[model samples]
Target: MAASTAQNTTGATGRTTTNTTIRRDTRTLPAAALGPENPLPPLLPRNDPHRVSEEQRATLPAEMARQIGYAPLTTVLPTRIRDGYTRERVPTAVDVIVIENDRLRATVLPGYGGRVHSLLHKPTGRELLYTNPVLQPADFALNGAWFSGGIEWNIGATGHTTLSCAPVHAAVVPAPDGGPMLRLWEWERLRDTPFQVDLWLPEGSDFLHAGVRIRNPHETTVPVYWWSNTAVPETEGTRVLVPAEQTWHFGYQRGLRLIPTPRWEGTDHSFPLRGTYPADHFYEVPAAARKWIAALDETGTGLVQTSTGALRGRKLFVWGAGPGGRRWQRWLTEPGSAGYAEIQAGLARTQLEHVPLPAGAELSWVEAYGPLSADPAATHGPDWARARAEAEERLTEALPAAELDAAHAAWLPHADLAPTETLHAGSGWGALEVASGGHELPGTPFDPGTLGSEQRPWLELLDAGRFPEPAAGAVPGPSLVSPAWRDRLECAPGGPLTDYHLGVAQWHAGDRAQARRSWERSVAAAPSPWPLRCLAVADGCEGHLDAAAERAGRALDLALDAAAPAAPAAALAALAREAVPALLAAGRAAEAGRALDRLPAAIRAAGRFRLLESRVLLAQGRQDAARAVFEAGFEVADLREGDEALTETWAALTDDPLPEHYEFRMRPS
Candidate 1:
């Protein structure tokens, strides 16, 4: 088989037939280039200044990073195993079998990316689990191929949607001594497909591991979030335990509890699932964890669910200590009343093992999965310390040290749950909602957050300040914006980057003092390129153009160096140029000149600054000379581009006779 790719899910044909493995270019975006703007919006608002308002200063809950308790749970293999064959590093995608001394066997299938038309389950030996029906892929929303994106999808793909579950590997590991061993096949295929798993107790073993391996073909990497959509009839009873801070209360709203990240650091928060909820997609677990859900029941079903980590890093177990709701979740035939406990662990970074390497140069992540369970809640009894110990011990003894190290190394890329820096490689975030509409944001940024179902790209944007929200205008009163990257901030006592935009918002709303304060807090707390820009905006709006220019110049450098969007920085630069004379008149010519020259040549050419330059130059008695620069340089171009082609929202407000400016109306990149 020549190195290439093929998707069984029919859409359109004509894929490249070459066998050359496509490697992701490590070229950091010149602006950390992700996509060459494919089609960067030709026109953007010219409003860079954020005028503060009283509403901007509205106090909100401060969220912090460490509150959610995000730590990678590591399991090093037991050192007692023999050398060579038994202790050799277990490569991913290899099939191995475990033969028990007491007479039991388990098969391991790693990285087998295909459909299992014939369902197969073990242990219990009732092929019914896999034989009932060929659970074909669904075509509706609650789950469907409705929201999809790839360069081709953008070009001309019908429906433009589909859930992606890319498979990674499968490992058939034996249980400690002679217990219920497992055949763990980790795959990431979108819109979950069911399989037949066999559970063999082998007379003496008390535990087993259920594993599923998937295949991902989509260009974008998404967290494998398929729960047991089909509810097992609990004529006996069933329960799913999920960790959460406050059990999702209120109402079932959209068949799922939509939890907002406290602030945009990274969803690093978690608590026990409390109260009642009939969830379809209960988003109780924070972004910190995406796979590894647990299910158990009063009748003795202690099942631990989980997935493999992708680029986002870290796998999770979705349950904690709590019993706030009913004993079991509503069956699929009924409503899903409980939530799943899971974690978002990063995936292995090496692509040397993939069959047909994916396109694009960004880091991609897919989840690995398995189901660990127990039964008769009372059978184990109080503390159930013995049972817990047995399970833990089996899980520990299941692997040899070499294999664990190899797997651990593969997963190192996503080890840091709290990634404070942007990806030097490919990093993308798209809005997560599956919109029923067509092409929004046209030629601008890919906005997945506003669309509704947040993908990693959207989260990255919010964390990186690409969306620049009032994410859906906030909730008013106290809360504002959904918390995706909430726990990564300095929030609670105050968070990083929180006040920077708020200051700009208040500044834009004309709340100078609050803007100043927010700006101060923004810089002091995190000191990003934003704080300087916020300070500049505050100064310019307050008629302290001289100070504004100083702040603006510094901010631009930071934004440019970070490969961040330049619209805001550009707007600030243009505004500072206009404020030169105000500085000179205030006897600050030295600093004012420096600010003017500091503006990059490209931004100065945008034209908004010429208006102020006209005033500044004329005041310096170089009226003719000033007129020449304004007319030949700035004004003429402004006239050609027209007053409407500005990137900053407050551009018109700046002496540039442009028009009303607002960043929201501009397309997001």
Candidate 2:
């Protein structure tokens, strides 16, 4: 952690300022590698029930209607599930980009989705964010594999960004107010857009400024989502303040209700520890109010996040004081670690909505993060209005709203400045997109030279109008579901691989019937398991459970037979996961058991398979065996956010209350 520090008197405005240094460093932590992704494609669409009621929808403004759940993802195709991480932890060195001034230090992890891993205030030597002790990947992001802590830029969909564990291009650029700025940019695949984040620390400022811009290069309107999620250490005395008397409460029960902001259910909901279950409190900030949110402790000193007017919404997410909430805290990191809550800012009122970016248009906003301190008694007082006023007064004093607006205007010109140095490289998809569409993104260049193996096939298809086939027994490559690529794929020479990818692209476009026909043609050309499993999904979606089971079983058998002896276990596990559930749905419990047994012993030992095994055992009337599976204590690495299967299965097996370790229920029943 040692590094050299020096003073450089240079400013973006040509005025001399205090000392500031921008350098690279490494941190050693107990980390687990994000292993290979699931080979099986996600055929089913994201079916999270995140819709608002008719009455609530009617009350929303016209712009809200355009954004609410627009262009829902049919599938997370191009991005695969990253469920390969395990509980085993080993010390590893992680690269970090540090930008520090005389008053503060901001450590950025460009390799980890450009996460602001730590923000330290120099005067107090206090960390402003909840910096995680270990790097543990969990199934939290939109495409799985997310770590908890620091500040994360959530984009693309409602959930965490697909690039949570992926790398992003980083470089040094000129800061608006002075010194060097750290810029991170990447191509967001779900919306087919490119976005950039510039981090600037003025010479002597406590606040870390982030300039964000998302551009839709296509001719058609695109639904865009952006949220800056900051994790702060939570304690019983911590209180969150937003300038709103009412808030939207959304629990895991798939319902959203407007309730009083601070006091709800005769308890102070502003305190993260007051609730009994995990929940989201989206503050209903007034249109005229300055948009900001702060998490202050009893002593009235903590992190505050504020943005320009365009970034309108603010929220607080807490894994509450309940047993399940406490258990989740331990599951994400190491045991006995301090709990944390998320204070977030977003474009829409709720994460369930997306804002529409018009054709060939872009949206830009500036967010400032720093430490806030106010009178302890007033901030933690019984009077909610006084507490909020104290926070607002302190925030304005630290960083004025007008100052933030001026900063945005000043940074606009520098946003397009070319990078002086490239620190890290992200995915080649952005370059591939530029290669195909010929986009002219100036500052955030997706250099064609960065294209690698993953983009080679798509590049070939773009150049030759044919998707190249992989070697025998090799898992299918990544998918491209954009309209232009789909059109090229449609005209490509018909083959097993080409037809299979075309079916996926068609499915993403919502043409189910055509997708089915394409998959059938793919199977007819070459009877491979990939297309067969896809057909299984189609059957299940169509409510042909028996046919789905049969297809899944056939697909599983083919995959096992064709797999090499040393093939990655994930390849087999992917098919087995789909087949087992389908078999159970078709009431073929015995067949499910046989299918589960076919997997290697180690794969079956994983948490997901063990849960499936419990279901299979219960179906066979072996209640004791099912209970044993739960008692063995397996962790579902890819357990979805709102999935209640764990608790539901526990209830079905016995009358006993669900075990604390398995209690991830976010809703109060």
Q: What are the RMSDs of all candidates, in order? A: 23.3, 1.9
Q: Return the lDDT, model 1, position 650.
A: 26
User: Which candidate achieves the best TM-score against the true structure?
Assistant: 2
Q: CA shift at 287, candidate 1, in angstroms?
A: 10
Candidate 2 residue spans exceeding 4 A from truth: 1-17, 47-49, 53-66, 563-567
Model 2 residue 612 CA deviation (Å) reads 1.2
Measured with C-alpha atoms, the lDDT of residue 646 in candidate 1 is 29
| lDDT (Cα, tens digit) per residue for candidate 2, span 288-326 | 999999999989999999999999999999999888888
**Residue pairs in clash, model 2:** 12-178
**How many clashes in candidate 1?**
140
lDDT of candidate 1 over 1-669, digit per residue (tens): 112111111111222221111111111111100111101101112221111122422321122111111111111000000100110112222222232222222222111121121112345442111111111111111112111110000000111112111121222222212222222221111221112122222223222222222223234432222222212212223333332322221121211122432111242222224222212222334456433333344544443323334332122222222221221111101233333332222222110001222322222222222233453443234333344444333334433224333443443322211222111111112223112112222111222323333233234343564433333212111112212232222232343445553444454334568657866875776555556655665576567766766666565555444433344443444345434544664566555556666667755544445555555555556656654653464322121111223223223224443322111121112
